[model samples]
Structure formats: C-alpha cells, structure tokens
Target: MATHLITGASSGIGAAVTRRLHTRGDTLWLLARNAGRARELAAEYPGAHTLVGDLADPGRLSWAFGHQSPPQELDSLLHIAGVVELGPIGDLTPKIWNEQLAANLVGPAELTRLLLPQLRLARGHVVFVNSGAGLNAHAQWGAYAASKHGLKALADSLRWEEKPNGLRVTTVYPGRTATPMQEKVHRQEGKEYDPALWIDPESVAQTILLTLDLPRDAEIQDVTVRPGS
Candidate 1:
C-alpha cells in the first residue's frame, strides 16, 4: 500500500480522504494547524499520525516536516489543505490576501520542499486539490483565485521537474464541494449554495485514489470536477 501525507486533514475533503485511505491500509501523515483537531483525526485511525501546527509559519512547518514521525514510510503528498476568504477587491485587506497566500501557497510549497526527499524515494505522486477559482474569476473571490493560481503554477512546475524521476503530479480543480470550508464561504457570501448539488467528498477521494493507482502511461496532468447538479 502507498503511504500519503496530507494537509488540512482536520476537516473537509482531507478528513474524508484520510478515512478512505486508512481503511485501505495506507499509512497517512496528517498536518494541520490545530493540535486538538489533528489529535482527533489521529484517534480515528489505528496508525494515523498527525503533525499539529500552522503550515504558514516557516519555523512551525520546519518542525512539523523535519520533526514529526510518519505512521509509515512517507510517499505521496496530497496538498488538500487550503484557506478561502472573500471580499470585493476594493474592500479586501492585504492581511487577508497575505494570510491566504501563506496558507494556500507558501505553506504547501515549503512543505513539499521539505518532503521531496521521501517522495522521491517512493517515486510517489503529488496531488493538488485546488479550486476552480484557481482557474476562473469571481467578484469577491480574489484572494482565493490568486492563491490557487499560484498553487496551480507550483504544481505544474514541479510536475515538469520530477518527470525524469518518475513522480506523478496531478492537480484536481474541484468546482464546488460540500465541505465545511464551502459552507463557511457560502454563509459568508450570504447565499445558499446547496450542499447536495455540490460534489461529494467521498467521490473526490475515490477519483484521486483511482488516478493515483493508474498505470504509468496513464497520466492526467489536471482533472476538472464540476458538480453534476
């Protein structure tokens, strides 16, 4: 079985993927900002281990990546962890933009740098669970859009760099998902974005695992998943 490390493992799609992979006997290393949440998730799986702290903090990220123990050999890394904040361009604050950038871009970039050795050893895959906002534009989704764009660029560049080494890099741009973060954004927008109409977390996990298990010739650089409804 493959070993995977994931961020934003406290909730949303990360949580779902954690459960799915754990049941399949895959070792998981979880990274998150909240110790309590990380511990809670760790408790759910017999061998699951979590690195509790903020990824935005370089020192903290160093601690988590360099210091934390994995449940098993660390292989793939699922960059599912992200942050979304909404406001019109005129009203958006630099603090918010920087915060999201730190969480959504720098954090993942730095963590991947730290874990590249292990991933290289396994010849593993790197999954970027980015948002459609990374590919499109929205009135108040400026911060999210910028961060995701950076994330996509990062994934693409790394994909090229790792091709000779036989590592697979995929970016899954999800349109809408029924996740806690989605709910938070929906509520912030003061609109009802039906969760039922949104993509299913379990389905996303299924797709990711399937893609990861595909034959060496079958490479999907990016997969766009939009809600059916």
Candidate 2:
C-alpha cells in the first residue's frame, strides 16, 4: 500500500480526500494543528496516523516534527490546508496579510522542504490544493489571492527543480467549492450561502486521486475544477 501525508484533513476537501484514501486502505499520515486535533483525527480515521504541526506557525514545523515520527518515505504529500480573510487591500492589515501568507504559502513551502528527503526517496507526488483566486484577483480578495498566486509559483518552481529527482508537482485550482471556507467567504461578502451552486469537495477529491493514479509515464502539471452547470 502507498503511504501519504496530508494537511488540512480535518474537514472540507481534505477530509473528503482522507476518507477516500483511507477507505481504499492507503496508509495515511494526517497533519493536525495540535494534540487535541491529532487525537480527534486518530479516532476518526481509525488506523491513520496524525502529525501535530500548526500551519499558521511555519517557523516551528521542524521543531514540531522533531517531537514526532513522520513516515520514512511518502507516495504523496498533499498540501491542502489554508486560511483566508477577505477585505479591500486598503482595509487589510499587516496582521491579516501575514496570517494568510503564513498558512497558505510559507507553511506549505517549509513543510515540503522538511519532507523532501522522504519524497525523493519514494519519487512522490506533491499536490497543492490551490484556488481559482490564484488565477484572478477580484475585489476584497487581494491578500488571499496574493498568497495563492505565490503558491502557484512555488509549485511551478518545485516541479522544475525536482524533475530529475522524479518528484511530480501538481496544483489543482478549484473554483468556489462548497466548503466551510466558502461559507466564511459568503459571510464576509454579506451574501446568502447556496451549496448547490458550488463544486462538491468529493469531486475535487476525485480529481486529486486521478492525478495520483495516473501512469508514471505521464503527469498532470496543473488542473482546474469548476462547478458544473
């Protein structure tokens, strides 16, 4: 069985992916923000493993990982955890910008760096669950979009840098998924929430699985998922 590590597995798309993988008997190592969250995930997924590392504090991930045992080699590392805050650029504070950046961009980068040895050993795939905001910045989306755009850049550079080492990097940009994060976005925008109008998290999870199951002779560099009409 293939072994994988994933972030943001508590709910939404991350949870969807974890469920599918765990059901099929893939060994899973899930990242949780704290001890309580780790225990919760351990109970929820039964046999899956949990790692405690707060993405908001990217600087301490190494120290945090040192305290725990991570998988020796990984088939995939899914960077799916992120935080977002919506506001006009003028009204957005350094604190808001920093929080989003730390969770969305820098945390993923640091985590990948720390796990490169294990990934290279297994020729693993790295999937970044980005957003449509990464492609276009609308009003009130400046900070979150900026972080996602940086994520795209990170994925692009990593793909090239790790090509010879046999690491595959893919970024899946999903548009307005019906997630808790989307609900929060609606609240910020002062709009009504409609789950039917957005893409389902399970659909995105399937797309991710497709990339992972593809033949080793080919790779999907980037894919975008939009809600069906």
All candidates' lDDT scores? 0.83, 0.97
The number of the candidate with the highest lDDT is 2
Using all chains and alpha carbons, the TM-scores for the candidates as numbered come to 0.94, 0.99
How do the residues 7-111 of candidate 2 rate in per-residue lDDT, one tens digit apiece? Answer: 999999999999999999999999999999999999999999999999999999999999899999999999999999999999999999999999999999999
lDDT of 1 at 46: 74
Model 2 scores a C-alpha lDDT of 0.97
Given candidate 1, what's the lDDT at residue 97? 88
Least accurate stretch of 10 residues (summed lDDT) in model 2?
Answer: 1-10
- Write candidate 1's Cα lDDT for 1-229 as tens digits: 7788888766788878888888889877777687787778778777977777686674577766456664434568999988888999998888998889998999889888878878888888899999999899789999889999999999999999999888899999888899999999998999887789788988788877777888878788899888884
RMSD of each: 1.7, 0.5
Q: Name every residue pair that clashes in candidate 1.
A: none
TM-score of model 1 (CA atoms): 0.94
